[model samples]
Target: MSVLVLNTGSSSVKYELIEVESGERLANGVVERIGEDAGRLAHDGGAVEGRFADHEAALRAILDVLGDISPEAVGHRVVHGGEHFREAVLVDEGVIAAVERLAPLAPLHNPVNVIGIRVAQRAFPGVPQVAVFDTAFHHTIPPHAATYAVPPEWKVRRFGFHGTSCAYVAERASALLGSDLSAINLIVLHLGNGASATAVQAGRSVDTSMGLTPMEGLVMGTRSGDVDPGLAGYLARTCGIDADEALTRRSGLLALAGVSDMRTVRQRADEGDEAARLAREVYCHRIRKYVGAYYAVLGRVDAIIFTGGVGEHDAEVRAMSMAGLERLGVVLDPARNQAPSTGERAVSEENGEVAVLVIPTDEEWEIARQTLQSVRRGAPQLGDHA
Candidate 1:
């Protein structure tokens, strides 16, 4: 049996088909620029470009490409499950309603996630669909770390994002160390377009950089990671800018270096651009601070695993973030750090107190595995395919 995982964004849908037993990816692809003048669907070494009008059309196009592949189950990557969903759940009307109701927490992501679920339910009826949340893995964070010093009536607390990637990489890191996961302490830095740092103690999240939303963590492509709380009000009063829009869409690397992409920022910095240079400093500084903080939280970290786009591919970022951290038992070998390699490998000195590693995250496969488990546990089945 194969499980199909769908990760839906505002204007994009990424999917993968994985064999449930072997965990082998059979096919994977994405539909980009939906609801725009020009949209494209690329799948299994082929590309289809057109003006797709909506998400439904994009999903249908994906199904058309799948042709004869009939996945036994479907998995969705829901951004925010809130406190209601502590784990993956079977998609029923009630679950759908709950996901919709919780959209205020993940305004930009959960709705599109629901759209993917609805479309997939219609396209592959009778197939069990599971909602694998990004926040679920971090639910194990202690109340002291997850809670904020806010009014009790407000009910606001840290709801860490990127738990899916953290979960996958933590397991991979444990295997790479040849150690028992429950005995090892780790700090997982998922540095992607949207970044987060998680402190995993005994295989559970003790603390995470992201708080209440994805925008609270490390500096990201467009989101400002940890700005002063007062800055929002300050922006509103002085600049007439909505705090949410500015922080979520107009800030971070974009506001700092005038470019959201890290590669471009690094290139400009290499050319002696002061702004880009400062941006990289700020970014790496934040990461180092979290690494130190999480090390304290975990007491003795067995490994510091770097994953995601920037963490896995950017050698400079990996090295720069760990700079000056040698006293903390985290040291990087310059040769190993800059080595051209792939998969899971250590970049730190041999026999270092704390192992530094770069592990590629596979969230899609993780989602598919979770979905398959949920299905086998007797999740409610749907009707025939639409």
Candidate 2:
């Protein structure tokens, strides 16, 4: 059976059509710059670049390209399900409302994600659409770890993101160790345009870096992670800047080095740019602190896992992030780490206490797999259209 996976962002939609059983991607492409002057959709091994006015039109055109594949199910990567959704849910009017209700919690994600789901529901009416959340797997965190030091009535608590990637990477790390996942302690670092670290104890997420929002953890592409909470009020008063826009947009590596891409930062650092150098140090330092913090939390760690864009592709960041972590049983071998290996594999020294690994994340495959299962296992079986 085939399942179509859609991951819609505020201005972009990434899609993949997969053959569920074999886990092979049948078709995949991205629609970028949606609602902007230069929006485009790249699909069927070709790219079309132009202006896409809204998500509805973008998805409709995407389906038009897919034609009559008759996917068994549709899966969407919903960013924050809060405490409401713990697993993939079959979309209905009720589900849509439920997702929309949580948009305030994920201002940049949920609303746009709802648009994707609604558009899909219209184009492929009745085809079961499932939402697999990025916050679901981290739901295993205990109350203490998930709770914030805020007033109980305020309803603030940690809701970790990038869970699907962590789930897939944690399983892959277990396989490489030749051990049961439940028997080992692992630290998962998911670094991309966004980044966060998760402490997995015996196959469950006991603690993670992100708290309440994606902006509260390790340094990220455009968001400043772990700034003093009061800085918002201070910055607003002193710099006359809106706190939300400042923290979410004009911050993090972008603010530190004037660039969000790590490659560019590294390049400038290579050329002796002091700001770029400090940005790298700050980024790696934040990761190291989480490692130490999680090590204390996990008590014992079997593996230090890295995944996502920067984690898998940038060996330099991996090495620097784990630098001086050897005393805590984390050690990386230069040759193995620098070796051009792909898929999931280890890069740690032979006798290292914590096995450092690179597990390439496959969120689309995970979404497709979960989508098919969500449909067959419990979703009402009506027709392909539904």
Best by TM-score: 1
Off by over 4 Å in 1: 9-12, 31-42, 45-61, 379-386
Assess each prediction's global lDDT (C-alpha) against the native: 0.87, 0.86
Candidate 2: tens digits of C-alpha lDDT, residues 271-350: 99999999999999999999999999999999998898799988999999999987888889999999988778789999
lDDT of 1 by residue, 6-33 (tens): 9886557889999979868899998876
Cα RMSD for candidates in order: 3.6, 3.6
Q: What lDDT score goes with residue 24 in model 1? A: 82
Off by over 4 Å in 2: 10-12, 31-68, 379-386
